[model samples]
Target: MTGPGLRREVRAGWSLFRRDMLKFRRERARIVSSLLQPIMFLGIFGLGLKNVLGGTGPFQELDYIQYIFPGVIGINVLGISMSTGVTIVADREFGFLREVLVAPISRLTIALGKVASGVATAMFQVAILLLLSPLLGLTPGFVQIVLLMSAVALLAIATSALGVLMASRIRSVESFQYVFQFMLFPLFFLSGAFFVLDRVPPWIAFIANLNPLTYAIDLFRHILYGDIELGELSRSLLLVNSPAEDILIIAVISVVLLSASVVSFVRME
Candidate 1:
């Protein structure tokens, strides 16, 4: 039998989930902007850089736009998913979180519900971008498409957890915006989002390897093109030494971050 606390937590999660959905329903402009930004990046940067980087070896024999679509998609998912934390902070400032906290629900449930809502919204954004990927020349078979979606879903969940953790630690929206800008730009730039990692300097490559975003980008690249050497991909980017090892690392990281965020939220006053 579940304890009173556990039941309250579950009920609170449902309530928070409904509230988040309603908030999104009211913010139609933000929703449209999130969906449009990725598409614009794909059309402008992806295709615009295609010609100049066309002869580059890593991207050789493939259209540059097609080669980079997976990475771009991954970046978009990361940004949108991570940005959900802003909403949490906004709620706290606006007294919505305070009202919710007065209820019997466990803090962990509130955190989980926020992350789940963010992940759901991110998945929807990804779906919209994916539908337009064909215009950018990404045509995958049924199984490949499923694999791609799975990879993005995993990425979304991980980033959402990270976002929740960040939100829990910050008290003000202004502070969060500054911190997020600093955190995300470096993470995105260090990642192989716009260029091949191997071609980057040794120091930069080392840092990129340490960045979780690199592993995510590599995983998505494999799913998209299957051009990269699985052995090199596994070792250099993921530091896992094998495909199974890489998957294990990603699974562990995602689970740990998610759990940490939930626990932190539970402990929050």
Candidate 2:
């Protein structure tokens, strides 16, 4: 993996990355729709529930908007990263994917480049959300924001890999959309984004523990809520896993999914 061969592979991956970013930039409607859903959840739903959750128990005295802010960000990243698979289907339909598959580069490099592009797009959306955090009453410190973004980048890698895996053999955009929606809603809802894991039934909690986004959202909470004062019950309800455990789980999942995506891409026609 050295010499001119290595250099050529790098260039190929870079080309793919650049082309995807440019395509994403040109899709203004996609950019707006991607950011819009999360904002609505954070604003309308959070505020609506703020009063309802104020009375007692774990949610007592909780600032619902501030509490679910990280969760909204998690859902945003989840949807955007996993939806990158849709682009692969589009490329396939237009024969662009076939052209790339025949190119002189390892499938590993191609997969990595695609995952990187998806991660870049998801993070771009996250940066916008972070900028609007203050308006949403979440004034995280500069250091906290940096750490949170870094954590989220790791999460994005795994999710984008999953997207690549999903799109690997699918040839139709219509089929991809149906499958994407089927998985997207369950993953987002079960990830503890809109509800507390502790409040769910044992069976549901068991299922959530298996979700990668669960760990990612918990990791986000650790970074974003580090400075905020929270009650014991609130902490219990929010931080599902310790930061160290969350990192370990997400890192392993990312490695496994990345490897799987590369294998799937290589096997694709």
Candidate 3:
């Protein structure tokens, strides 16, 4: 791209990013509702399960919430990415998409703006929960906290790009909703976000390994509670055999998703 063209892309992306962020902040109900589910999982599901599990065996000496907090963060970020896709579909339905489509900037830039907004929303949700981490006995140093946020942002980019790719292919908000519903929970549960992947059967472990969210959650746990013994079953279930490998795999996946989203938009009617 030429210098002027590149500058235009950046400007366009920023404008779209700002617009989405403003809309996101203005919806107080949306913010509360987006957060309510994760908090419920932490309170009702985690606490209820804590009584039954009781830090035994592989669980060691921690409560269930402590075990699942990383997973909850993972779910929260992934949920934001999925919700961003719905906004893209809604834009298409409501006619704003036509204005975006005819803009002088590249389509990829427009897509990146949308993806950036989704990443911000995901980070915002995670930050709110991070403040409550001390109650769950989780704390991280400055560098560790930065890495955790960076890891979540990368995961958001990957998932939101994938969301946009699907959104570009579908015609209506209802059709997009149908496909996203089929995708969301399976991605969350199969990621082993709420439990130990190690404790599961071998076949289940294999299935979990296929999910990209698995690597992101593992990264979160390592950053927050690095010393915990997650065992071979859980560790082996990770697509990356080592920490460096995990980072490399996630970086590659994020790039792939961006390319896919761009191609998908180019082909859209």
Model 1 alpha-carbon drift over 4 Å, by segment:
1-8, 226-243
Ranking by TM-score: 2, 3, 1
Predicted candidate 1 versus true structure: per-residue lDDT over 59-84, tens digit per residue: 55566677567767778888888888
Best by TM-score: 2
List ranges where model 2 is wrong by over 4 Å. none
**Candidate 1 at 232: error in angstroms?**
11
Candidate 2: tens digits of C-alpha lDDT, residues 214-255: 999899989987777788877887787889999999999999
Model 2 C-alpha RMSD vs. true structure (Å) is 1.3
Which whole-number lDDT from 0 to 100 does residue 115 have in model 3? Answer: 90
Residue 166 lDDT, candidate 1, scale 0-100: 89
Estimate the TM-score of every prediction.
0.87, 0.96, 0.92
> What's the CA RMSD for each of the models?
3.3, 1.3, 2.4
**Model 3: per-residue Cα lDDT over 93-209, one tens digit each:** 898999999878788888888899889999999989898888887877778779899999989989888888888888888888888888877778877677666668887778678
Worst 10 residues of 2 by lDDT: 54-63
